[model samples]
Target: MARVYISIGSNIDREHYVTAALDALAGWFDEPLISSVYESESVGFDGSPFYNLVVGVDTDLSVAELSARFKQLEADNGRRRDVPKFSPRTLDLDILTYDLEVGRVDGVELPRGEILKNAFVLLPLAEIAPTAVHPVCGECYQVLWQAYDRDQKLWPVDFTWQGRRISQASAR
Candidate 1:
C-alpha cells in the first residue's frame, strides 16, 4: 500500500463538515493518521475562518481514484462546484502527496504546491508526517516547517471526533 496524505478544510459549519469528513475517511480507510485541527482566517477571499487538518492513509488506489474519491466526499458534504474557488466551503479535500512521487500524475499534482505556500497545510502536515520527505524539495516536513518564513497565521482549536478530544486549542 502506498502512503497517501490529504489536506482537509471547512469553513461553513466547520465542525460538522470536518467531523463528517473524518468519519467518512475512517469508514472508508479504517483508522487514519490525523493531525491536530487548526483554525485560520480564510486565504484568497474574505470569509469565515476555516478548520484545517491533514490525514494520512495507506491505500492501493491510484492517484486518480483517490482524487475522485475525495472529490465525491466533498460533494456529498455539500461542496458546491458552482461556487468560486476561494469561497467558503462545506468541505474541501485535496490530495497532498502520494508516496514520494513528484510532478503531475493522473492529472493531479503530487506534493501539492499548497504544502509549501500555506501555513494551514504545512503546519498540520509537519505535525503528522514530520519525517516524510517532500517529493521535490527533498526536506523533511518538520525541517521545512522550521524554515518556513511566511506570515500566514493559524492556531490549534479544541476539537473532538468520535467521543475523543483529538485537538486542543492553545491556552492564550
Candidate 2:
C-alpha cells in the first residue's frame, strides 16, 4: 500500500458536508490520519468561508483509482466542480501527496501548490504526520506551517468523523 494524503474542504452546508466527507473517507482507508478541522477564507475565487482538513491514508489503490473514488464520494455528497474555482461545494478532496508520485494527468497535478502554500493543508497534515517531510522543500510539515504568515486564521470547529482515534488531539 502507498501512503496518500488528501485535503478535504467544504463551505456549503459547512459542517455537515465536511463531517460526511470525513466519514466517507474513513470508510475507505485502513488507518485514516485525520487532522483537526480548520476554517479558512476562500482562496482563488470569492465565496463563503471553507472548513478545511487533511487526512493521510495508506491504501492499495493507484492514484487514478483513488482520484476516481474521491470524485465519486464528492458526487455522492453533492459536489459540483463545474461551477467556479473556490466556489462553495459539498466537498473538495485534493490528492496532496501519493507516495511522492509527481506528474500531471488530465490537467490535474499531484503534489500541487495547495500542499505547500496553504496553512489549512500544512497544519493539519503536520498533526497527522509530524515528521513527514515536504516532498519538495525537504522540511518537516510543522516547521513549514509555522514559517508561513500567522495572520491567516484557521479555527477549530466542533466536528468529528466516525473512526478510531488516530491521535488524542483529533478525538472529540
Relative to the true structure, how large is the alpha-carbon lDDT of every model?
A: 0.94, 0.78
* Residue 17 alpha-carbon offset, candidate 1, angstroms: 0.3
Task: Give lDDT tens digits, candidate 1, residues 103-172.
Answer: 8999998879999999999999999999999999999999999999999889999999999988999975
Q: Estimate each model's TM-score.
A: 0.98, 0.87
Best by TM-score: 1
Q: Give residue 107's lDDT in candidate 1 (0 to 100).
A: 97
Error of 2 at 145 (Å): 1.1
lDDT of 2 by residue, 92-164 (tens): 8888987776677544586777777777888888888888877777888888877787456676666645654
Candidate 2 ranges beyond 4 A from true positions: 105-108, 163-172
Q: Give the TM-score of candidate 2.
A: 0.87
Runs with alpha carbons beyond 4 Å of true place in candidate 1:
none
Alpha-carbon shift of residue 39 in model 1 (angstroms): 0.1
lDDT of 2 at 46: 77
